[model samples]
Target: MRLQDKVAIVTGAGSGMGRSIALRYAKEGAKLVVADLNLAAAQTVVDEIRDAGGEAIAIEVDVSDRVRAQSMVDAAAHAFGKLDVLVNSAGVGNIIPFLDTTEEDWDFVFDINCKGVLWCSQAAARRMIEQGRGGKIINLASQAGRRGEALVLAYCASKACVISMTQSMALALAPYQINVNAIAPGVVDTPFWDRVDAQFATLLGLERGEPKRRAVAAIPLGRIEQPEDVTGAAVFLASSDSDYMTQQTLNVDGGNWPG
Candidate 1:
């Protein structure tokens, strides 16, 4: 087990990529702190991990809240005696055109996507620094960040901020042996798309699911990525295998948004 006896904190662990990453970490022998906005959802993940013979605890948290984010770190330290990894996976997506994107919309996106990362990373870095051992911070970025999406202006901007923050954090924490990096995932098959399909249908006056199908066909991979597709890269980054890696954004987009 690459992460044997390690302590990991995964935000947004209620579902989707966050839930998958939490499960993956637990399978590798890491004791998990699964935090999410929904208490029940987090509990479900905790139950799943326990059923698999892994140690985990679920906490309800809103990453956008600094107090709640710090409390999450405090809880993890209390349970596992230390914090080794912090994965910022909580985020929101928006698909409104740039002109129509209200200030409220932009604020919501940035608060949950970028500010949430800031709060969690800050809280986790404090613990890691106190422990005097290196740590890992993996943030969830997006292909939309690399190539701006017109309809998802706020979301793209927020993820772009995440990528930049990863670089800045890596440089600042290098002396402390803490590595900060990000993963820019492309289209993944999740309930997110179902919501997007419905929203886009209403926005465009088109039949439901039409935009989704078109988006899928546009991807070179010919299919949306599954949550599992992201776990392998995450495991590598969180493990000793990536000791020399930092300040990087690894894209797991099935060839989408190629440079």
Candidate 2:
């Protein structure tokens, strides 16, 4: 149990990579606060963890809201008595063409994917500082952040923001012994693709699913990434294994892009 005795708050824990990390953290013996926008999905995750004899609580929250974000941290500290780790895995994406991108589109994407990370990490870091113990703050980035994409302009920029924030936060929080890092996942085959692919179908004039097929075929690993593929990296970052590492955004993209 790498994370035994640790208490972690995982945003977006209702599904996708967040869910995978939550379940993985529970198995490794972390008390989890499963926070998500969907109450039912979050509760279901808590139920699964409890069924496995793990400790967890589900909290429905929109991480973009600063107040709610602080409350999420408060809930974690209140429920578990201490907070040791935070995985800012909550995000949203869109595939609008460069010219089609709007102020609203950028705001919508950044509010959740970038600003949400900011709100949550600030609150968690404050608590960690008060607790006087080292902690881990892992942000969810994307391969798209490493390079610009024609069709997904806003998403690319937002993830790039996440990476930038990871660095700034890591540098700033290091004195408090909090290691801030990020996981840049590539093409993970999850419900997330449904919305992106559907938008690409109309934007790129491709048949439905063709965009995803192309994405998978481009991966040097020869397959789409799964949520489980990223948990190992998360576990390492959240555990003492990566105590000396900070201000780094590790690429867990299965060779889709080499950093």
Candidate 3:
């Protein structure tokens, strides 16, 4: 019950890490607003939380849209009365080689990964500032952002933006007692990997699971990352435990990208 009586909005809560974070927050006594582009998936999470005796609602949202992102914040405040935490997890990645990366590829990834974070954070921060109490903003970064991967140039750049924005938001909102932070996850085995695997197969001339096999083999922890592996870091950030921390990117990558 670390988040007792708190209200939280988790973007991309439909699946993977976002879904895990939403459920974890609910378990901590926080009312949740599960936002995702997939209404059905978001509702599934809502059902899970409600079945567990926790309060939650689902909304369909494209975080890349500023107006839609603001509406999401408005809906949360309307439904739950106040917002205490925001987790931006909606993102995309492509595995084209650096030379093959196109402007459209960059736009697609950045729109959701970077621009989406900005829009959602802005909307959430406005509500938190008006509440006159501190709030937590957790963004999803990636190990790729700490360095560059030739195969995912656009994605790497976008996540770097996540880290940069986290720092900027932290400094800007510190005066208002709002904390902005990020979790840099690595090699998670979510449905997202299907896309990554397919892209790698096409671009790297590898088999469907070969790219993933190589990734898993490289993990120092001896296992691929799971969505649940990221929940603890998120729970800490959303709870009072991380009140003194901000503008920091916690590596939940199982010893990968230790930086």
> Number of clashes in every candidate structure?
0, 0, 0
Per-residue lDDT tens digits of candidate 3, residues 62-157? Answer: 999999999999999999999999999998888888897788988999999999999999999999999999899999999989998888888998
Query: Pairing residues by index, what is the TM-score of model 2?
Result: 0.99
Model 1's lDDT to the true fold? 0.92
Winner of 1 and 2 under lDDT: 2
Which ten residues in a row are the worst by lDDT in model 2? 189-198
Q: In model 1, what lDDT does residue 25 have? A: 97
- Model 3: worst 10 consecutive residues (lDDT sum): 198-207
Model 1 spans > 4 angstroms off:
none
TM-score of each: 0.98, 0.99, 0.99
Please report the TM-score between candidate 3 and the true structure. Answer: 0.99
Candidates 1 and 3, the one with greater lDDT: 3
Taking the tens digit of each residue's C-alpha lDDT, what string does model 2 give over 1-259? 9999899999999999999999999999999999999989999999999999999999999999999999999999999899999999989998888998899999999999988999999999999999998899999999999999998899999999999999999999999999999999999977797888888888888999999998888999898899999999999999999999999999998898878
Predictions: Cα RMSD each: 0.9, 0.7, 0.7
**lDDT (CA) per prediction:** 0.92, 0.95, 0.94
